[model samples]
Each structure stands twice: as structure tokens, then as C-alpha cells.
Target chain A: MILGRVGRALVVSELVERLRDRWVLIITALFVLLASGISLYGRSAADAQSTVTAPSIVTLSTFLVPLVALVLGHDAIVGERERNTLGLLLSLPVRRGEVLLAKYIGRALALCLAVGVGLGVAAMVLEPGHRAALLALIPPTLLLGAAFLSIGTAISALTRHRATAASLVVVLWFLLVFFYDLGILAALVATDGALSQDTVAWLVTLNPAGLYRTGMLVSLVGTEALSQMGLAVALPSTALKAALWAAWIIGPLLVGAAALHRRQAVTG
Target chain B: MKVQLCDIQVRFGHLLALGGVSLDLRAGAVTVLVGPNGAGKSTLMGVLLGLVRPDSGHVMVDGRPHQGLPRMEREKLGYLPEAVAFADNLSGRQVMRFFTRARGLSRSRADAVLSRVGLAQAAGRAVRGYSRGMRQRLGLGVAILSEPALLVLDEPTGGLDQQGLTLLWEILSEWREAGRTVLLSTHDLALIERRADHICVLHDGLVQAQGSPDQLRRDVGLPVQISVTIDDDAAVGALVAQLQRGGLADVQIATDIDGRHRHLVMETAPDDLLQVLRIVDGAPSSVRDLRVAEPGLDDVYERLLEVTR
Candidate 1:
């Protein structure tokens, strides 16, 4: 479609501009490297007695990839509006749908490249057997990153202020990454290791990061080991995890696109 | 023949961006929309560009509604926004190339368009380094690309030097001559009067008036002033008597110069003035510079805006 031309131009232009901003690009690349490095080392330490395998690499991605996804996605909408380039982009023949779709697809593509580089770095630092597992993680990693970016885009579309959007994103990151764990710890303490069945079920599966963790761990350690850790029953199976990832990514993407379209109607 | 908006209405929250606005843009004719800030000029432009949808009514380009306006149809419609901001990292040439490619034009066509806009010299320069006027010219160049059938310009003359203004006017004139409709929204009334074949005055979210410059001035029907300077007390009394006896319409003495010398000005037509002149003197003495000054477009604009408000 001719409308796709605008999308292509917009993506190419965004990529070129981001590439020219060396400091930001370098910082993002470095963050990916550091996160990948941390995951590779942590996995090796956790598996000291056993040989690292493809599944072990999947565990590393499940833990570390969310961090990269959150950072890249939260700036999508608010940043363009802040730069005052959104209006210029809208004035083109490109429909608002195309613009949103392009932004989502383009950012996802860019993130894929970054993740590829990061995965390569992780492979380099990990045991040779872990490479296949790391490769297996790419699809979900991309979906997870897309989900976070979509949430960020939704937040951006909802507000005029980029700082406000960024702040909310940070709060979300804290809740997903650290506060969920804190809540789980408090629940465990309150229950004296005898929490109610429903309470335990809810806490373990509340966060997407937690889902990624238990799912990847179950996939790695097998059903029997997952049961010993007291999580196989509470956590969803690999199939359910796959479904959640799809819902997490697709739901927000649709919501963000709808919001963007509505907002454009109001403003334009 | 090219574009027309029929009783368009656009509401922005509590503000009426365009309230029952209508316009007709004919092929090969340049119509200028002139108004002050917040007068809905830009809103009308936006409607034509299909960026903003009207609350009611429709925008038609060549007998087809804007919703039905095909991409191929709009490929012939060139638009230069009030102030365009391109990618800073890309050269002006690159920016032009991107737009041309988007418009489905060849790379060589983009080069020709850039050359037409006088940007060929600085084609290699980054758009970040372009001055406001140069950027404006580049925007116009983009608007003219693909040899568009309709060119919609929003404040195209803004930030341009006198020479640039002349060049832009010449280019616009050429477009008009080539049977391409040009719709320009500007604050430059003088330029509109000079270049636009049709002028629309927007005020308070409505069209205050629309017509040729002379027709608008005539419809406003401003008063013509008659100025006179007399010698002393002797001539003052004679002038006043002559003006009164002349039986002119809306006749009134303006000033008395310290009970002796006086300056009298009356509102009367030039052709209707010979009777007053014959009464003032035997032929044409004592009275000096009996000039009849009719209203211009500026006066018409002020009067129309004042009455509408």
C-alpha cells in the first residue's frame, strides 16, 4: 500500500536519527551487553554442579530480557510528542493507524536487532551447550519486549508529558521487577510457610516477569523438579506461558493502537 | 473546480475552530485566506489537507469527498505546512528524496523539484542548518513537486525576504497560469490583494467577506473624504457657506482655525464635487487640493471585521 511508504520512511528516518545520536545508542547497546553479561554469569553460578545446556540459556533470557524491553519501550510515544515531531509525521498522507503500526513494528524490529546482539554476547560468555537454549528464547524475548513497549506507548498516548509517562513506566518496572518479589516475601512471612492455597496461587503468577521465570525454570528443570520447588502447581505450564506472552504483547498493542487513533482524532 | 468546502464546521472542545466555513478553489486560480491569529485560517487549511476532519459538511477535491480522496488523487495535491520540520540528520536533498519517493516520483523528479525551489545550491546541506526562510522555500518546493494540480500553502511568505517574496509570488503565479489551483492562507493582506484572484477574509471562526479586492471594497461601501484648506476668516466663512449651499450628502465642517483660518473636509463623491467647487470660488481659487479619497481594502477589512463582531 502507498500508506506503507510513509511507515517505511518513518522507520528508516527514526533509525537513522537514533543511529546518529551516538551517546544514546552506545548507552543502550552497553545496557544490553551488561544485562546479557549478568545473566550469563548468574546462570553459570547457579548451575555449578551441572553442565550448562540450551534450557539454562533460556533461563537467563527469561530473567534478564524484561529489563531491556522495559527501557526501550517506555520512551516510544512520549519521546516523539516531546520532540514535536508527531504532528509533522501525522501531516503526511499516512493514516494514524499506519503511524502507530509503523512505530510498533519498527521499534520491535530495532529491539530484535539489539536483542540479537545481546544474545550473541550471552552465547559468547556462556557454555557451548547453552547456545540452543539462548536461541530458543529469542521469540518470547521479542514478544515480552513488544509487550512492554506497547504498554509504554499506551502510557505515552494517554498523556502529553513525556516525563509523566516515563515516571509511570519506572513505577511499573519497580512493581514488576522488585515489588512483586517483596510482596511475595511478605505473604510468605505472614503465612508462616502455610499460606492459603488461593493466596499462594495468585502471588506466584501475578507478574509477567514471574511468569517468564517459572515457565523458563519449569522448562529447564522438568516437571518433577518444578514440583519440588513448590511452583509447578501454582505456576502455569509452558503452553499457558506462551498464551500469556501472546496476550500480554497483542492486547497492549491493540490497546495502544486504538488509543493512538482516538487521540489523533481529537487532536488532528 | 478543484477543491471546495461546503459549510464546514469543526469544534475543538469549547472552541469552534471553524464555524460554518465554506470556500471554493478553482483550477488555475489562487485564493488567499487572510485573517489574524485564531481566526480559523489554519483549520481550513488542515481540512483541505485531510489531517483534521470537520464536525459537519464535506471537503471535495475535484468532485470527490476527502474521505474518498484516493492517494493517487492526493498525489496531485501539494501542501506546504506553516512550518515544516524535517529530519535534522538528513540533508535537504535527502528530505526531498524521501517525500518524492513517498509521492511515487522518481529520484530525478525529486532533483528537478529541488532545483525549482532554489534549493539545488544547498542540496547537500543538512536541513538543520537551513534558515527559516530557506526551510519555507524547501517546503514550497515539496508542495510543487509532482506538478500537483492543487497547491495548498499555509503562510508561504512567512519569514521570507523581499526578494524571496517576489520569487515565491512569481512561482505561485506560474502555477496559477498552468491551471493548478493554489489555496494560500496568510496574514499578508497586501500580498493577497496583489496576487490572489479571489480573497476570503476569515474572522471569529467565520468568513467575514469573500470577493475580488475591488468588489470587497465596494461592498464595504466606505466613505470618500473631501479635504480643503482656506486662507483666513474671509475665506473660511465663504468655504463653509459654499459647502452648505453645495447640498452635498453627509456634509459637515471638520475644523475651524482659531476663528479665522480653517480646514474643512467633507464626505462626498469626486464627480459630485464640481458644484461645491464652483460655489467655493468663481472657478477653483481659495480652495486648495480638493481631493476625493475613497476607501482601500484595509478600510474595508477593518469595517467588515468590526461590524461582524
Candidate 2:
């Protein structure tokens, strides 16, 4: 069957498996520590301190969620293939696309939980005005992690071995999370600031990480901060940015499904 | 349900994994596919499961042609691969529940299959703690969670102990009684020969032979062995002489490995078995017991492969 129905059982199992993993516990603990550490030292009587603590949480997740997401999803498909469960699973009513999509959703949910609980407890330390803002940081954090999870699943599909998937996902995480903005900065400097502000604004939205940064700045800090950051001219609207985030989450799953189908055809 | 894989041909580039194969699987029968490594048995199973799309021929299920078995039809099939793997972190019960949900079975069925497979005690244990045999039993449990009409198993007995084998036989017996179709591929021919209702032997990407056990033996025309116990060792000669006088001269004394226990053994064509028995019966007082060993399935399979080779 082509594009058959997704198996909810599979999605649930993937979620359960991820939740049971030791690495998930470790990531959650790391988030707890990071959120607590940032909130512990940044507390103040004034409500203006909310921006400082909440933005730090978002920034930390921006740095850490991709790593956790890639770690969670790197084995989603190749692990099943290596274990030889994929063939047996396909013998059921499930299709190849269904399995990949289910893994994506399942792992994404686990990451969402990690972001929720890991940073959620810190809301007790902050004042009422920004506690909601601190909570608001979670949705975008999950979106950013979900985009990486998509890329990780696709990497799992394209590679033959888990070792290869692990390495490839790390390389992708490094390039996208650690070096993407840096590369963009280098490109802007190479042009001697000759690049149009509109072009730079459009270019910044191409990366999911960059788009997340833009959305966070606009939502929390206002348009004045965005114009000061020099990406305010002709930046994408919030709806378009959400669509881009969704595209990041879904496009790679499609590519993973295609790769899965082609591999079965050639190898069977 | 009846499944017909007609004229199926699958090619991976220039190497033909399955070439012009047609197989008929009937209800209430255990049809076994036996072959050497790389004999296209797995490729054929893959086609049956819709994992491999045949380049040429189509599949017909219950007389309706299909590109392959449709997704809805696949729900009727229970497949067990050679390597049965599951999420190690999950408990055995959780794994079964997952499959139970995937098959759209009732919630209680997960425990029911665990009980049926003799895994009720270990249901709460993590699957990583399960032994190889337990894992195989779990795989079988998952395969049968839906009680599918057709079961396709690859190397079902790989890691099974004797008790596991007995449990499997019991399940297969139930399937037979229910008139479900079962197809399995294995290297253990001698163990499964008597249990299987029909045997299909594949060689070099083609079916060498397919038939009931008796039919294959008859087609191969292998000799039947007759063993007789005499009252005394001296009667061995008398029986031999009596058989010689009765025009059945080819007889030898069969001895155990230690050469202490002995019996008069003779070989005859299956058609001549009755006549040979009559001749041996002619010497009545000397004979204590008698038995006839029909040609074994492995022998017939060997002869068939020999001819093809």
C-alpha cells in the first residue's frame, strides 16, 4: 500500500521506548539543571527580570534541544532495520511511510515532554508576569527540536548502519546548530555589509534555527529589538514562520519515506 | 484462505532472486518450503508478504488477482522473520500490547497470547532480559496476536527448545484444526517433514518439487526398508533361507551400533512391500516382530536434488 494509514500502536511504542531510554532521562536532567541554574542567579524583585531568565531558557534550549532531538531520533529507522523488525512490521497493515511518520511523532512527543517538564519547574521561581512567558518559550523550543528530529529520522532512513546514522546526524547538528548562524555571519561580512537588508532577512529565515530566533525576538522583545538586530526589513510574518517550522518538521519525513521505499525495492 | 503466487518473478538488477515461481497454498495444511541457502525461499516469502514486488507475475488471493496482497489483506497474514527483534527496553507485556493494538485486537488479547505462548509468568519482565528462546516465543506470540488466517514464518524453530517446539506444534495443530494456511521455510527438514502436510523444495531459484510426503517418495521411487526381529539368533539364517526360497533373497542381519542386538533387514520397492512381508511371514515361529520403514522425506528430497544437480 502506498501512503497507507499510520499505526497508532507504533507511534505509542516509539514514544514509550524513548521515554524509557536512559538518554531521555539524562536530557531531562540537563534541562532541569540548566533552567534552575539560570533562574537561581537571575531572580529579582522587578518584573523586568523575566526577560532575562526566560530568554536564557529559550537560548539554552536553542543550544541543547537539537542535540537531544538528534540523539532521540537518530536510531528511529535504522535501528528497526538493523534489528530486522521493519520487515515484520510491514507485514501488518502498516506502510513504510506510516512507520516513519509514527516514529517522528512519537519521538517528537517525547522531546516535547522533556522541554515541558525540564523547564517547566523553573516557572515557580520567576514572577507572575514572565512565568507565562517562560512557559511560552517551550512551544518554540519544541518546534526547533522537532525540526532536528525530522532531520535525524531522515538521516536514519538514508544510512544503512546505526554507526553511520549517528555520525551523520552529529555532523548535521554541528553544521546547523553550532555553525549555521556563524556561517551566515561570515557571509554577511564577506559582502562588506553590501548585502541588502531584505536579502539578509529572507536568508535568515531559511534555517529553522534562524527562523526560531527571529520568531522569539519578535514575540518577546518586540519589533524595535528586531530592527536593531538588522533583520526587521521584510521579515516573514508569524504565520509564514510557523509554516516554515512545520515544513522543517514534515519535509524530511517525506524524504525519509521516499528513501525507505526505494531501498526496499532495490534490496528486496 | 487460499493464496496463489502465480508465475512470480523478482530480479534485483541482473540477479534473479525468484524466477518464474508459482506456488499454491491451501487451507488446513502446513506447507513447508525447504531449500539450501540462497535458494530464493525468502524472496518468495517476501513476495507473499508484499515486501517484494514481482517484476512479472501477479498474486491471486482467494481467486482475485492483486499486484501484491493489499494492505487490508495483509492484516490477515501473520509473519515471523528469522531474526525476531523487539524493543528491549519495553516489557514483554508491553511489546505484545503494542502488537495487539497494531492488529486492532482487544486489550486482553495481549495477555491471552502471552498465556498461550507460555509467557504469562515473564510478561512483566523487560524483553532485554528474555533468553533467545523467549524472544522467539514472543515473536510467535506477536505473529499470532491477530489469529490471522495465514501465517508466514521464516526459521520458526531456530532458537526454540524442545518445549518451545512442542508449544509451536500445539499452535500449529490448532491452526490446522481451524483450517488456517501456514507456510514456513526451514533448514530442519527431518524434524518438520512429518509435521508438514505438504513440502515444496526449491533449488537455484526454481521449485525442484512440490507434493505430499507420500507422493514425493513414490515419485522418487526409493526403496522401503523392512526390519524383522527373530526369536533366536539361529532363526536369522532360517528366515534368510525362507526368504531366499520365497524369491526374496536380498536380506542382511541388522545390528545395533554395538553389534549385539540384531534383526533381519531387507529392502524392497514400495510395490513389493506386501509380498516381501508375506514371504517373511511364511517363517512364522522364527519371527517375533516386524516393521516396515518407508523412505524418509529427506531421502526423497535428496534424490530430487540429486537429479536436478
For candidate 1, report its TM-score.
0.77
Span of ten consecutive residues with least summed lDDT in model 1 chain A: A48-57
Candidate 1 lDDT over residue span B177-274, tens digit each: 89888888887676556787888999878998998887887787776676667655566666666666756645555455465445667766545656
| Docking class for candidate 2 | medium
What is the Cα-based lDDT of residue A35 in candidate 1? 50
Off-target runs (Cα >4 Å) in candidate 2 are A1-6, A44-48, A185-201, A220-230, A265-268, B226-291, B306-309
How well is each residue in A87-113 modelled by candidate 1, as lDDT tens digits?
Answer: 445656777767776666666666777
Local accuracy of candidate 2 as per-residue lDDT tens digits, A114-173: 988877877767766667877878888888999999999999999888999999988888
* C-alpha TM-scores of all predictions: 0.77, 0.89
Q: Which ten residues in a row have the lowest lDDT in candidate 1 chain B?
A: B67-76
lDDT of model 2 at position B99: 85
